[model samples]
Target: MTVKEIREKSNAELLNDIETLKAELFNLRFQQATGQLTNPARMREIKKSIARIKTVMTERELSNQD
Candidate 1:
């Protein structure tokens, strides 16, 4: 998802998305370890998405604290 899309979600939704992504990441790692992964690049995408979500979350938190 793009930053705009990510930013549109509520905090609860963002947290849920993060949990889902983390689960997917774990499964992808397992596939990689067993030589079953078809798309290794997905791992990179997922990591970046997680980072983006966290960045947005932090931004919101800081804004709220002000």
Candidate 2:
């Protein structure tokens, strides 16, 4: 997901997206292990996306805590 797309999502939606992306990343890892992955670079993209979601989630949480 692009940062712009992510910025548009509400926190609940972002959480849902994170869950979905993690599942997909898990599947991709399995595919990579089995040499069935069509695009190995996808793992990197997914990983980065996950990080972005988590970062935003944390930022929001921290702000709320203040």
Candidate 3:
């Protein structure tokens, strides 16, 4: 999801999504290890999505602190 959409989601939803994305990432890594992964670029996209989720979570935490 885009950062804007990620930001709009409630904290609970974001947390849940993070878990789901992490599970997908784990599967992607397994596919890569087995050389069964198609579209290698998808790995990068998934990594970026994880980063975006983390970045948004950090931003929310900083905002809460303020």
Report lDDT (CA) for all predictions. Answer: 0.98, 0.90, 0.88
Name every residue pair that clashes in candidate 2: none
Model 1 lDDT on a 0 to 1 scale: 0.98
Q: Residue by residue across 19-54, what tens digits does model 1's lDDT show?
A: 999999999999999999999999999999999999
The best candidate in terms of TM-score: 1
Residues 29-65, candidate 3: write the lDDT tens digits: 9999999988788778878988998899899899999
Better of 2 and 3 by lDDT: 2
Question: In model 2, what lDDT does residue 48 have?
Answer: 97
Candidate 2's TM-score: 0.88
The TM-scores of all predictions, comma-separated, are 0.99, 0.88, 0.89
- lDDT for residue 66 in candidate 2, whole number 0-100: 97
State the local distance difference test value for candidate 3.
Answer: 0.88
Give residue 64's error in model 3 in angstroms: 1.2
lDDT of 2: 0.90
Worst 10 residues of 3 by lDDT: 38-47
Candidate 1, pairs of clashing residues: none
Q: Provide the lowest-lDDT 10-residue window in model 1.
A: 1-10
